[model samples]
Target: MSESAASYKQLKEEFVSGLSGGPVGEIVAVTAVLPIAALVWCLLQKRHAFFKPYTALGNVVDYLLNVGAALLAITLYANSAVLLMVLLLVPALFVLGVPPSTGARRKKPKLPPAAKSYNSNDSKDDTGSSSSSRDFDVLSTKPFLTFFRGSMMVLTCLSILAVDFRIFPRRFAKVETWGTSLMDVGVGAFVYSAGLVAARPVLKERAAHAGGRRAMAATLPRRLAQACRHSLPLLVLGVVRLLSVKGLDYAEHVTEYGVHWNFFFTLALLPPFVAIFQSALKIIPSYAALALILGVTYQVVLESTDLKAYILTAPRVDLFSRNREGICSFVGYLAIFLAGQDTGMYVLPRKINPRSGSSNATQRTTLLMTMAIWCSIWSALYFLTTDYKYGAGLSVSRRLANLPYILAVAALGSLQLFTYCLIETLCFPEFYSAADPKAEKEAYNVATSRVLRAYNRNGLAIFLLANVLTGLVNMTVPTLDASPLASMAILVAYSAVLTGVAVTLDAFDMNIKLS
Candidate 1:
């Protein structure tokens, strides 16, 4: 083969094979280290009861330990990490236990008269008004969930890039498997979800301002404008990144982003489009329909023509044909973003009161059921569309973000959310209350563990930090030459440094946001 062809072949082989596969191991290690380190730090601070169950710190420790234990089981016995993670929830729930409830005879807490603004004017009764207000409040208040979302994004980024350096098992990297890898599906879903969550405040504010018949009409233009503003910086960053890779002569995965299609570009562009559609239509169902239609269309086109090969091997890169995967996948990802917005609507309600039947147990049970149903329905859809016997099912192509890929992401993301909710509900029920800001802050500090809160507080900063460090590490270390144990150690140490930096910054109240 010619030098250029030989280079392409080498890159392809490198992408396909590397270290052993270990999605569960990487996830478990990353998740477990921070909380465990925090506990150790707490011990050093002379907090003797940090590991005791029922206390805030103890509850976090319990959850982390359970996660660790479950991961160990998956490593030793189970072939499916997703299934094992779900099954582990049973023991987690049992260990954490349910919140204590007020008896049926106890009267529900009275809402302040002024707080009634959360309710709709059309509410028929006090109970209806209270319910409406509470839901809205919960939607607006949950900082911890936002933090968790950011942290998940950071984790997904680290895992993927780590695999690039052979720091983690190569098998966990993106593959054309029947079911999707967690890391592969996670990164795109998290980015899209973050965009949706970030746009919620803007969406809600716009809707409120345009309350009359023109509400729908007025909101669309404003949201589109807002999305344009959001995308501008990302677009610039994407351009800078594209130029940097080309200029620096870094190893380029052509199919991953194509020549001009950076992730920053996708982030900059897709959310606004999704937001516009959402502003004009019913959010979840509409977007879900779009995803199905687009996915099917893409698949049919792929099978019928040489489009896939052309996209993969096209010589010239430009605004259109060569980057078709990146351009086309935006539709599917927007659908994912819309689905995330629907979830945010559900999980971030205005309030939750044990006395009003919107207790932690109720919420957790609801999320759990939703997760189960979605997973089952999506899995069935996958089997229906593609044959599993010959590994012919929908592959988790980040480039395609096809129907099965979307379903897998939605299901897995839901499972993650459910797990987090369960942990919060059982371990720190007091943190769920929207009424008392002081108490909520205290509960958040305890529930998340100080280190986690730090990471949460400076999520974007931590992500940037990881990227910079990753570059430095690649320059300094022979990553591909390292043993698995050395790679694991390096990853752990890298994560620890990130956690420390985040904690220190959060201590000084240095959390930064571009907008």
Candidate 2:
């Protein structure tokens, strides 16, 4: 047999041999700790660079706590009673309605100049109501939002687990149903709409931050130039992948559950448009408005018309089968992702100036409130959608910034960041700086440093590696019908192994490009 066949045979044997719980347990064990170790190594290498050991250590602790978030997602995916309970409990860290203790109350602050000026301007108006001209100030503390974010993060991670492990098979079975088709289109539309909304804020923020027309033009030209530079190589890779021997004939096998041939296509085509959309958020009255419009409209289209059948059944036919339906479906989902980001931003601004006299207790309370809100949402959604299996609809970009697949996206991003933080504290204390120097170390008057600088710097690289690994694992793993425990074990192990390999390869100045 050929080398590839032989490798598959070996993997199969491993699978059979690991039928008991040992392999899966070990896999989880490695995932649970290796990340922390790797983080420690990264930090010590950078320890001499004006870092705060204690603060760095704390960051690491936060990161590990974040890993607990993965359990929330596993529960969502597994839909097991145990997992669900975990999910429910995890969000208590951020829910809003939970009783506030004396330790949790935030003291109100005297209005800062920015707020005072705005109020004075408001009072000057004869009608005292300028809804259209109103400028909503970014809050120093978004207690409600914090909870929402924390809950969403947990739920999102859980969703990823569900999609990958196929825990809730009954929900997944809906893939064969007409309702699934409608849901797909509706979800797709929602994702796309949200993306458009989210883009608005980003664009506005950039435009405002730009010094002047000349300055803005300078940045635009450079950004555009950068895009142009990247495009050529990406195009070439596409062409080669299309004709190469390793090509999987994705078009011919479009119906396969785990096929991920179009990630690059989706990533490349959608972002530019989404960026433009995000800029428009500044003009919109509310990001939620955009989400509602898109969701309602998509729902109407899917349910009230023949769009679903045409998109799903007809698009699969030979003449129309160039993956048009799949592409369309994803476009819709992009809207959802965009919307989620926009809503998130609206609720939680990027910049927050803490009240000068605010007590630490208040800050902690705010954090808990955010966590509580997040938990409630997860719990509610869980109960409501127990029988629903959206079946990894086009809404989820799989691993990359999925939109309507809100649960998965939130969990993964939040927990991933949390884990990253944890590793820094526990394994790599050196990298953690009490003050993030890169956040303009001597900025106007900020006290704390940003949480993710280097990680953000290398984010694209890390994300690409993760995506490729996930794709490869899907391609290599045994069929979904494989033994349940075996499948979960292999997936967990595969994810850990690929992540390790990717990080190591990155360290060595060697990177693998996914086709």
Candidate 3:
């Protein structure tokens, strides 16, 4: 007899449910390996010359050492406790560019301003991923952003395939509900990342044609059209994904997003919603306040009414009920997305302030202080709202994406992003202080691994590829009973294929732009 969707759901339920996650600090530490290797490899990029005249081989080596290290960090975690601890410590210490005993960090001298020629070329594509922007007041290189995004994507890529295997730890899987886990954190992380990059960019390649002044007022129709332009592709992709899953009779955990809903649809909706509601969302105090308000209101409805019951236990009988989780949880995800934008607003250097004559050191310090404040506030909120603290003793549910989940995401996201920023500051102090956009970008380009940058740039393609490969593997191989050694071997090979594609794409100067 063929396995039904209900059977598939039950199998996965037996696999992932009824478990609280492992220690946050442990997962956080293992994750730190990716950035640590990336940033350090960037600083020591010249060492890759061992493969001179055969640069492709160098890319292979870089992938094995840097990207590959992240895989090993997961599969071999039990065996490398000391190394993981050390990887965790380097970021904690060097982020400050000072010793535990040091009073203050020594500042580096600033580079002269770039000849105004690079303004047009600095900001590239709609993503406004380039740190050197003509639209923003501040412009600095941000490999840290790339590193963080890549790390999360890689973790996601590896875990999706690995989870089917016995060697994959259940504690890291998505909990049934009301608890934290690695996969749960990833859901919020993606929402946060989307908002982080979609912060309206203050970016326009052709702003110069419009009197060379950034338009303070973009019309509502234009905003919606542009948001549609970006988000519609994802919607199309969502439809494609749905068709493929149903056509293949793929086993899907319907509760994840619901019968017809997936993350693509959820993610696609965000840009337009954000476009329509940004002004209202950016209410008093900060963007995050609106996020908190939305989450709290949603939680109140869930708690006060039968909405939570309807969400968790309702039959997938109708269209709305089929996608209830995606529809209802949207409010919480939007809150996370908005909070991410709020973070990007601060972390991204929008415009250079000419009046203050501020050095990058001073700017970094100020940003660090702001991050510290955010961290303290959110961490306290999380503790206070949890069952362990003085409040209602709520549990974090990825399924519901409750207020507690948002709070946890904010607290952890702040700390993680802060660490990434610190890595960039320490890895490339010249980047912050340098005035030449083209030159600083070149220097940054040289220091960071092209392989990582490839994954970072065309992340959507990588994700698509990983998903297809995961399905293919599951169809062909019996992953559920694979031994640890067999699982590790398969995982490493899978990761290598992903990395090789990234390297090849980087070599060809191709960016898939699907993202």
lDDT of all predictions: 0.54, 0.36, 0.72
Minimal lDDT window, size 10, model 1: 104-113
The candidate that achieves the highest TM-score relative to the unseen native structure: 3
lDDT of 3: 0.72
- TM-score-wise, the better of 1 and 3 is 3
* Model 3 stretches with alpha carbons more than 4 Å out: 1-13, 46-58, 78-83, 87-141, 200-216, 281-285, 350-355
Ranking by TM-score: 3, 1, 2
- Arrange candidates by lDDT, highest first: which order? 3, 1, 2
What are the per-model numbers of colliding residue pairs?
Answer: 11, 59, 7
Question: Per-residue lDDT for 342-429 in model 3, tens only?
Answer: 8877776533233465665776778778878888888888887885547778888888999998888888778777787776666555
User: What does candidate 2's lDDT look like per residue over 175-197, in tens digits?
Assistant: 33222211222223223323423
Question: What TM-score goes with each of the models?
Answer: 0.71, 0.48, 0.84
What TM-score does candidate 3 get on C-alpha atoms?
0.84
Error of 1 at 236 (Å): 2.1
